[model samples]
Target: MPFIPHTDEDITGMLDVIGVDSIDALFDEIPKELRAKELAGVPSGLSEMEVTQLLQARARIDGEPTCFIGAGAYDHHIPAAVWQITTRGEFYSAYTPYQAEASQGTLQVLYEFQSMMTALTGLDVSNASLYDGASALAEAVLMAVRANRKVKTTRVLMPRSVHPFYRRTVRSIVQHQGIDLVEVDFDTETGQTTLAHCETAGDEPFAALVVPQPNVFGVLEDVNALTDWAQSRDALVIGVVNPVALALLSPPGDWGQNGADIACGEGQPLGMPLASGGPYLGFLCCQQAFIRQLPGRIAGKTEDVDGKVGYTLTLQAREQHIRRSKATSNICTNQGLLVTAATVHMAILGAEGLERVAAACLANTDRLAQQLCEVPGVEPIFEAPAFHERALRLPAPTEDVLAALAEQDILGGFDLGREYPELGCALLVCATERRTDAEIAAYREALASTLAIAEAA
Candidate 1:
């Protein structure tokens, strides 16, 4: 919609109807000292055309840098139809489906999304969606603690190989709830959290073990072993996974003898663009036995009075619907719009199409790693088999090299030193299906030049 400013008369009429002299009067309840006198350093308003031109100019300045940094969020190709259909009046502006009768369209979309997610993860049930991958893992942790009756301890065996941000989020959310997150270190040689590392936690009973397939380092863990080990000790296994990788690798449901109790991860790779860190979607799925403990809402398909097909929210265990103390979670809503896009994206691609995408990503990253390793003083950090991303040790400092790459409008990759200083000068790089052969070659050339310049200095 084009910008339409209200006329002076329109403003006056609204103020009159509200019995307010001016817009400032609406905030009269706020103390004068607390209220800002003005938006300091703010630019003056511009004409619509001028504003559009200004934004376009700024966008041109940034150009579209080739994105190789996929620590969590990825740069996947989003089909044109995905957003075109999603932004329609019905889907874009749809509100919470408090009244199912009025929201069958939205309810149906949610149902399809849940069905697709379950199929991908090989789990029995999936929530509508969560805030993001990190928050979803936090919710998963809380749920594991609540559902695991065999374990008396609230300790969750968290691997250092898991995304560092996810670990921090779990701590911040569950710390006061008396949940203990015990860190499990990864093997330096393979960049994987081994059974030996998990054993370091000792024989003490813990609620759950977080198993990340193709963990933060992009190294595939021995999930079958990890899952079985956790279950033997009566500990639930929580799989932190990549949805795209799930297409090729075994799903969390097929992890081990009994399978992982819960699985969750960022749904950004499905269709979302890395628009400065999202508006991304988080997916949480689990076994049917843990359905009651699942946070967020679930959409269900059913029949109407006439026996016609219908859709509605089946499980709303959030704080809003149930007693606050009895609620499954304080999360009041789901990411409906983002879910709509993801559902459409999956429907467009289907199973075989998604598999091709996953395969392409793996091939591209492998090629990228091989090419980068050819450069002098650049080497693979781990010997483990990886998926779409890999860790590379650089003779040059990661931050400096990345900065130089950025100067050439190439987002090289993530600097591991910032989070994992022990890895010293290591970088994590990714290559999605969208990354072309030329783009990959360009990145290699840029990095080689950057390192040469650094060494000469």
Candidate 2:
């Protein structure tokens, strides 16, 4: 796509067709008070070569590091074919399938994506995809509150063990709708949410509870007990999980009692890359009973008039299908490209391959944690078993230690002190199957040497 300069006459013709006086007039629909006048300090223009040079310089500022950081987004190894086929003109340039019949290929891709997500989460239904994991969990909270027939209250329980960013995102979303997010603390030693915390939460009229499996510290929670407890109180249990971890742990749909009502999580582990924060998508799934409350779009398969197999968009729960006030979510656009990549990734790695990948991740993580803890100043903060990430207490400030490692071009881990103040100097590290033994060794050596330097200073 080459850029073509629009002539004055072309602009005038376009404005005339739209009954607008100028390009600025087209933005009249947006409130003038809310509009930004301009990007302050931005340069007017530059030659293509000059702009390219500027961008290249900016990109060089971030040094390449052997990434051990996995707070949420992971550095998993993506197959070469995954992106090769995904970027093909057909999938790359695709748009929303407004007319399902005409968009059979796109619809089928989404249908397969939804089917894979459902199988992964052990739920009856799954929407195509959501913006990201944080927003997806927020949407799940909304869905649970709306579908809860047992309670009229919007008070929801969120675990402290869940990712801090996710908790904050949920608060921002549901607070305006009269949803009260109650914090449930985790055991300091085990890094797991104790049932005692919820038991003490009292008989408040709550509608939903979020359970994060293998939480931020990577310690697995007691899913069965947590789910059963929420069900006993007539509150819907929403599981915030890792898609890869689901291959090894019990799926949300089999939690306890009647099982969790909704399961949502970051799908980056499935196929998407970190891409420096994200271009990653979220997956949302639920039991059949709450299928109508599922946000975004769902695709269904059927036979057409000619008896040929076909796929079509089905049960759209967005504002486009119904009144805005009654819609499940207004933010309901599927991550079509990322989902296509994910769908292809899943197809390539079937059930057995997925389990093997997950098992390998566990093995690598265990090995890394064991080696790192051998450093004098480092010790595993949590006694419980964690999948791929573990919190370690460092003798020095985590940021200082991380900075030293960064100098050597090794991305150590997440500084947990920022999110978990109680655990000072805590470092949360993870190692996926993508991390080779040599890379793990390098990280260990860097951290040990960095800590030694800090102590000497």
Top candidate, metric TM-score: 1
Query: Which pairs of residues collide in model 2?
Result: none
Q: What TM-score, computed on C-alpha atoms, does each candidate reach?
A: 0.92, 0.90
Would you list the clashing residue pairs of candidate 1?
Answer: none
Worst 10 residues of 1 by lDDT: 314-323
What lDDT tens digits, residue by residue, belong to model 2 across residues 1-457? 1377888899999999999899998888998899997998997787789899999999888977788889998888788889998999888887888876778878999999999989988889999999889989999999999989999888889889999999888788777888788899999989989889886678877999899998999999989999998899899999999988888889998999788999999998878878876788988999999988888888888889999999887775454556577787886578999999999888888878778888988898899999999999799999988888989999999999998888899889999998889999999998889899999999889888888888999
lDDT per residue for candidate 1 within 180-291, as digits (tens), equals 8999999999999999999999999999999998899999999999999999999999999999999899999999898999999999988888988889999999999999
Give the distance in Å from residue 329's predicted Cα in candidate 1 to where it truly belongs: 1.2
lDDT, candidate 1, residue 136?
A: 96
**lDDT comparing candidate 1 with the true structure:** 0.92
Q: Which one is best on lDDT?
A: 1
